[model samples]
Target: MIDEQTARERVVSAADRLFYARGVQAVGMDAVRSESGVSLKRIYALFPSKEDLIVAVLRHRTDRWNAGVTDAVDGAGTPRERLLAVFDFLAGWFREDDFRGCAFINVFGELGGGSDRIAEAVREQKESFRRQVADLVRAAGGPGHLAPQLVLLAEGAQTAAAISRDPDMAGHARAAADTLIRCALDDAGEPAAAA
Candidate 1:
């Protein structure tokens, strides 16, 4: 007698593990049913199709994941700290035993080109991440152009951290971010209003 919300959560949780462990294409609906213990009929009733379930899983991950990491970023004492906190958040995430890089990046690589919905979801997450950094960058007094560059650093850190299996890449990225911020603040060009 599981409620609809409970059943939905169970399905999404099962799908996340299965899909992350073995690409979305490899895990079948039946496996989700078995893992979640939600009858096939109920599963379908909750999510009409495998694609629907995949979309739902991505959405679920985005919501929960964003809330946690964004809180870390937002709770920083300063704008620059907020920017660096993003890498800190990533570092924490990379330490998890189940860490396998970002879910959006992983799923997009596996099914992005052919799946419009998947690509859209990944794009939305990426854009949301960039916007967060952009806000931090503006608040930190960095040049407007630095937002995208910072995003590249953040994403590169993720890939490097995953490949090297070393969370210390977060430190490297944070150092680079610090340097960028310093340079931006120290730039004493000829734009002096009172020559």
Candidate 2:
């Protein structure tokens, strides 16, 4: 028998795949139980309700994604490169076989403007992403507001790529990001540095 930790991890893994592929609302607890190979009782024992499971799943994915972004930026040699890392990461993600829109955005849409705990979670996650991007932009010597704009562009590209099934949409986004960075630096009386 799997240990509690192992069982919980299995359930989370299953939730990640199912929740991302299909909206959280579309996937039932029974599906999570079957996919994780855990009994329904065990699944409920781990997560008291579907909402709790959704929150757990969101937290898991958010942690993983933030870690990836941190690694990507930290590995860069320069601040400009670090800023560009966000785009590079998204570009690669867009090419993935399982690529879908941002999970938070998808969940928000699935909920349809309902004000609930899940919506609040989604909002917090998105704001966190924007803040991270803003910090990177500021570090790159771009204007203070550049991060929000870049994040908007990135989110728009993700939505477009998912809907149009066009992976290359990331290229346009990257170019736009480059221009935005250049403009921001110039506006700040700083010259853009080579990445």
Candidate 3:
């Protein structure tokens, strides 16, 4: 028998898959119950409401997504490569058969204006992505101000890749990022710090 925590995870995982594939409003609680194989009573007991379940799923996805990106960055040879590695990470993600752009972007577009909880979760995810970019920028000795632009590029690439159905979007974004980083280094007049 699955424990409560395991059962909860199953619910969240099923919800995450459904919500990402279909808009939040398009999916129903019964669908989640069916997909998760958790009893309907237990599902409601854990989430209380559909909105609560949505929030839980968003939080769970964000945690897992960030961990994946963080691991990719951590594995890089240098802080700068780590910066580029973000795009590499995205490239891998974009190439996935199930890739439908970013979950944060999709969820936000689906429910941002109507749901305060969802909006807050979306904001947190975007902020965390920027924070990761900012850390890379600082480590690479780039201008402190480039984090926002980097985030924009990263986001734009994801949107474009999803819409255009082109996995090369990541490659294109990586080139742009490299150019931006190089320019920053040239502007800083510091001999491109090793790696």
**Alpha-carbon lDDT, every model:** 0.83, 0.84, 0.88
| Decreasing lDDT order of the candidates | 3, 2, 1
Best by lDDT: 3
| Candidate 2, residue 135: lDDT | 87
Task: Give the RMSD in angstroms, all C-alphas superposed, for model 2.
Answer: 1.6
Error of 2 at 48 (Å): 1.0
**Residue pairs with backbone atoms closer than 3 Å in model 1 (clashes):** none
**Candidate 1: segments with Cα more than 4 A from true spot:** 188-195
RMSD of each: 3.8, 1.6, 1.3
Candidate maximizing TM-score: 3
Task: Give residue 5's error in model 2 in angstroms.
Answer: 2.3
lDDT (Cα, tens digit) per residue for candidate 2, span 135-155: 887777787888888888888
Model 1 C-alpha lDDT per residue in residues 29-70, reported as the tens digit of each score: 999999999999999998988888988899988888789768
Error of 3 at 171 (Å): 0.6
Tell how far residue 60 is off in model 2, in angstroms. Answer: 0.9
> Which residue pairs in candidate 3 collide?
none
Question: Would you list the rank order by TM-score, best first?
Answer: 3, 2, 1
Report the C-alpha lDDT of model 3 over 51-154, residue by residue, as the tens digit: 89988998998898799889889989876688888899999999999999988889888888999998999899888889989988887778987777778888
Poorly placed runs, candidate 2 (over 4 Å): 192-195
